[model samples]
Structure formats: structure tokens, C-alpha cells
Target: MNVKQEHLKETNPEHEILDILKNRWSPRAFSDKKITEKEVKILLEAGRWAPSAFNVQPWRIIWGIKGTETYDRLYNCLDEFNQSWADNAQVLMAGAFKKTKEGDKENFHALHDLGLFMANVYTQAHSMGIATHQMAGIDFKKAQKEFKIPEDFHVATGIALGYYGGDASVLPEDLQEKENKQKRERKPQSEFAFNGNFQNKN
Candidate 1:
């Protein structure tokens, strides 16, 4: 599948936004093309600049490119559902965050900061013609143990990174339907963007 053909699924945003943002969507199908080390570093750099509470910068990523022992370890941390398709990705990553502040106090905002870090990585990858899928379907405890993560940190998500547009036929029948989806949908601003007090759109 050609990369250009994948753009047909770009979202129809109600308001103008960056083309990269509009075009970005998580795909279960990934091209096997390898991502260069330099490109990986660039994506990490983008995450490194994300703002954090008191600049604690709690986010951390343990990543490995395909065909490496590290990659296999990361892949094993994913749940069975993710492993079904994520094996085709060129790179895999474990996203983690430090749970404590300097005094061992809880950093309630750690997960939020990690999300910001990922948003930067996602935008950067999209600009580079790369596609990324972030998954919560991972064995966090397994990832923590496999990576020998310290007690202060916790694994939160797994990430698959690769080029867009792969052979959907390689996926299971149900997943192939998702891989070939032509439209992207999102909640309207009114549903979640309240002008003042919160209102339950549901």
C-alpha cells in the first residue's frame, strides 16, 4: 500500500488545525521498513521538550528497534491482542513515568505529563511521515520487571512505531477492516469543551 493512499483516512476536523494533527491516526497495520537510529533520537528529543509539572519531567521511554533482543523483550510485555499486529512495527517502546517527587511525595500529575510527552512524539513522527500507535494493552508489571525499572517508576503504555500503509491482508480479518477504514471520527468540542461549569454531554 502506498503512503499517499493512507491519507484518505485523514480526519475532517470542524476547525482548522495542523495538517499533521488532522492526518494522524493510530493504525494496527505497519510497514516493516526500519526506522533509523537518528530518527528515533529525533522523536525522543521531541518528547524530551515536553513541559512537566515543576519541570520534574517524569516521563521515561525504554525503546528498541526491531530485530534486537530489546525489541523482543518489549514485544513480550504487550498483551496478546497487541502482539497480534504490533509485531509488524519497526520499533517498540515502553512508556513509563516516575511516580514520586523529590521528597518521595506522590506526583499525581505524572501520567498527565507522560501524555504530553507522547503527544510531542506523535506530532513529530507524523511530520516525519511516520505512524505511531500507543497501546494500553500491555502487561505493565511484566514491562517493569523486564526493564528492571526502579520502584519509583511505573510502566504505563506500549508504543508501536513504523511507516504507514502496510498490507492489511497480513492482519486478521476483523483488524483488516479497521486498517482499511476510510474515515476518522472524534467527539465534537461541545461534548467535552465546556465554556464554564462542566456539563454531562452523555
Candidate 2:
């Protein structure tokens, strides 16, 4: 049971947006095809140009291709649920951030900056016809220990990358349903975007 990227693409939007932004989505299913090192480097280059507070550019990434020791170690850091589906990913990455500035002062915006970096990476990957799924279920401490990450850095999230379209039947039944879902939903702008002062839509 092969799935096509078009089958999962979001066809409608409340307002017009770029095709890439409109079409990009995170999918649990990934193809067995391998992504080349050059392509990975290009994705990182996109992230490298993302804006950061005070130009701190605090984002750091530890990535590995499948079948490597580093990939196995990174996979071990994922929670059982993520490991179940992410095992099919051709590439895995741990996204981290520097928690402190040069003088040891806390960089309060580090996490936000990291998000920006990942946004760049995600959009770039989409443009290149690659699919990406970001996962929050990971053992941060385990990743730090396994990668020998510095004390000043914090592991934030994990990422799975591969070519778009895959065998959705390989996923667990529940996730298979999700992978096959065609409609992409999100909160309307009215719920989050403010007119004047901030208003809690919740």
C-alpha cells in the first residue's frame, strides 16, 4: 500500500498562502529511500540563515542517517511510541539549543530561536520534496548523555526526515488512519491572531 504526497496535501486554506507552506505537512509514514549527505547539508544551510535574538543563533543539531551507530543511539533516545513509527525514517536528528549566553547569562529566547531554525529546515525540506516529522517524545537526558552534549545545551526535540510518500500500511493501525487522513485542520486566525491587545481564545 503505497501513499502519494498528493493524497495528503492540504488543498484548501482560509486565505491564500504559498504553495509550499500550504502543502507541507508532517507525516508518520516515510519511504525507505535514502537522502544524500549533500541534501542534508543544504537543509542545514537553510537553518543556518534563520534569524535569532541578538544573533545568538543558539540552535544546534545532532543528526544521523539510518544504519549508523549514531542513528541507533538517537533512536534509543526516543520514547517507545516514537520509536515504533520513526524506525522507518531514513534520517533522525536531535534538535538542541544553547541555554546560556557567553557570560553564562540565560538566553531566554533560545527555544524560540530554535523553532525559527527548524521552520527554515522544514520549509526547505518541503521545497526539496522531502517529508519531515518532528517528535517531542524523546528522552532528553539520554540524548545529552549519549551524544556527550555540553551542560549549557538542552535537547529540545527529535526529527524524522525522508522522501515524501511511503507505505502507510506499515504504520500501526491508529497511526495508519492518521497517515491516510486527507483533510488538514488548524485553528482559525480569529482564534489566535489578535486585533489590538492580546485576547485569550481559550
Candidate 3:
């Protein structure tokens, strides 16, 4: 039986925030819709503008849409678990950080900067009505060798982009149950935030 996909949008925010942020939760079921090249550029441009230490902009993104050889390379670098669902995504990308910039010493904040870059990509994507899922489940060594990534760079994560699909039945029975039924969860600010100095909030 053909499992037709429905458009799905489910978000629950504990406090008032940008609608984009509220709507941006990763989905495992992605519609097989094609994403345009222009849209892909917009996402990358957003990442390019993210602030980095000393403006080094350490993050390096390599991306490809489905049906392209680049996509095959990117997809092949995913672990078996991620490959299970990531294949349905319209676009695949690898994020990496350059440990050093031209003639510069190792940047201690490179990883932190990459996180900000991805956040920018996520926000930009959500604004454009695109849903994205970032995963750390990747064969990092394979990504490096397959992509010819330099020794100075560290591959950080994988990103899958596409429209959200509603037909959870396409997934494994266990995952289908939680597809759109699960609630977004996060720890309260009190647990992480502090007044001035550390206090035993636990």
C-alpha cells in the first residue's frame, strides 16, 4: 500500500518566543519533496553570517540534494541507524570546523562557533518553511575520507533537510508511535541558570 504523506506541523513552547524557534523541532519522517537550489543557498548564506571568534568563521559546510553524487557521498557517511531514515531527506550536509585559520594558531572556540553556525542554518530553514534534522550519528572517519576533508578540519555533524511528512506508518512500528505524538522536552532555566555564583540547585 502506498503511504501518502500529509504535511505535519506540531510545536509546543513553554514560553513566548519566535514562531520559527517554536516550530523548529527535528522530524524523522521527511516528505520526498525536492528543495530548490536557491533555498539551499539561502541556508548556507545564513550560516556564513554567523559570528565566530575573531571573525574566523570556522565552520565549513558541504551539502548536496538528493539525486546527486554528492548526496550519495554525504548519505554514505551516516551510520546505519541514521541511514535508515535520512535517505528520505531532500538534502544532506556535513558540518566541519577548521582548527586553524590562515597562519593562525588553533582556535579553542572552533566547536562552539560551529554550533552557532548550525543554529543560524536551522533558523533560516525554519523561516523558509523547511524542516531540518541535525545528527551526530555519523561515521566521522568515513566523512573525512569520502569528502577529502583536510587534517586541520573536524567533521562535527550531519544535517538533513526537507518538509515534514505526516505518514508515520512508513517508519518502524516503535518510531511511528512517537512520530507526531511526542512532546518537546527541555530542562527548566532554573536548572542551568544562576543568580551570580554557583548554587546547589539540585
Q: Write the per-residue lDDT of candidate 3 for residues 119-156, one digit (tens) a residue.
A: 99988887776788999998888999999999899999
Per residue, candidate 1 scores C-alpha lDDT tens digits across 1-202 of 2247535485789999977777888887777778998999999999999999999999989999999999999999999999899999999999999999998999999999999999999999988878999999999998888889998999999999998877888888879988887888999999999879999998
Instruction: For each candidate in turn, give its C-alpha RMSD to the true structure in angstroms.
Output: 1.9, 2.5, 4.0
- The regions of model 3 sitting more than 4 angstroms off are 1-14, 102-104, 199-202
Compared with the true structure, all predictions reach lDDT values of 0.90, 0.90, 0.83
Candidate 2 clash figure, as a count: 0
How high a TM-score does candidate 3 get? 0.89
Better of 1 and 3 by lDDT: 1
TM-score, prediction 2: 0.95
lDDT for position 129 in model 1: 75
Question: What's the best-to-worst order under TM-score?
Answer: 1, 2, 3
Model 2 lDDT tens row, 1-202 = 1235564565688989887788888988887889888989999999999999999899999999999988899999999999989999989999999999889999999999999999999999988878889999999999999999999999999999988878899899989988888888988899999989999898
Where does the lowest 10-residue lDDT sum fall in candidate 3? 1-10
Q: Tell me the lDDT of model 2 at 122.
A: 92
